[model samples]
Target: MSTNKVIHALYNDDDILMDAVKKVRAEHHHIEEVFTPFPVHGLDKALGLAPTRLAITAFLYGITGTAVSTWLTWYTMIADWPQDIGGKPSFSWLENMPAFVPILFELTVFFAAHLMVITFFMRSRLWPFKEAENPDPRTTDDHFLMEIPVEGNEDELKALLESTGAVEINVVEKH
Candidate 1:
């Protein structure tokens, strides 16, 4: 089996972490991962990550919800069970659409919200009883951690990380 060496640099502040990331990239170092206590604005841009497609998925899911609700309303009110209430006969779906507005809107929102959540969970590969992938527990509380793979330049990388104001730096072997 082969083992890979990586440098883990810990920072106390997000702003400092951001600057360090920029400097690391400027020096042509590839950052493996960054762990932050909270979401850092513009971090993805700084890391050169591509934009996510979750919004597109959400829009498609919402359209699907609207279609399902429309079909359900038409099938139940106009096709399956036609009722005459208050001297008005349910003969056409368009004419009876105003009365089914609440159901349509409710089901549309319900399906979109529920399905979006499920889709997010599935896309993120999250599931119940899954083990945590955190490298440093302190990152979950108040610290920021940047992981960089070592390429036989531990000293140079460590010096650079120290110059970037890393509070703690460690070189560890990852299997």
Candidate 2:
């Protein structure tokens, strides 16, 4: 597969970068990705990207994990191993719920954390031994990069980047 041509821009100000992003998006709706050195608030809204649902999934997984842990503990300790320890009631599942709550909570958090991490990794295609595709090394250090796939007028895009107060511009070819 042929990778798309990426035009990289380095910006110093967030407001300028935001304005540039708006202009680029308004004039041409073909921007592939934008990278910032620091977190820019409301950037996602500017990019028209939807809010993520990972927190919701994590909560649901936590609840499921809690339920499973509770059921398993109750079944094993109350139903299967019904031995009265210290003359306590053998079939007291509800009374001894407090004793098993810590384990249940821990398991729930563990499952939620692990499952959410896995979900994020799988969804983002990030895994072990995966090579990162970074257009410029400086982008991660201190410069913001706005990447546009070169599909139409190259001069117009270059002019747009220059007009947006980009300090530097570089055209990257895909392998």
Local distance difference test, each candidate: 0.92, 0.84
Segments in model 2 whose C-alpha atoms lie over 4 Å from true places: none
Clashing residue pairs found in predicted model 2 = none
Winning candidate number (TM-score) = 1
Tell how far residue 33 is off in model 1, in angstroms.
Answer: 1.2
lDDT score for residue 139 of model 1: 100
TM for candidate 2 is 0.91
Indicate the residue-level lDDT of 161 in model 2: 90
Q: For model 2, state the Cα shift of residue 70 in Å.
A: 1.0
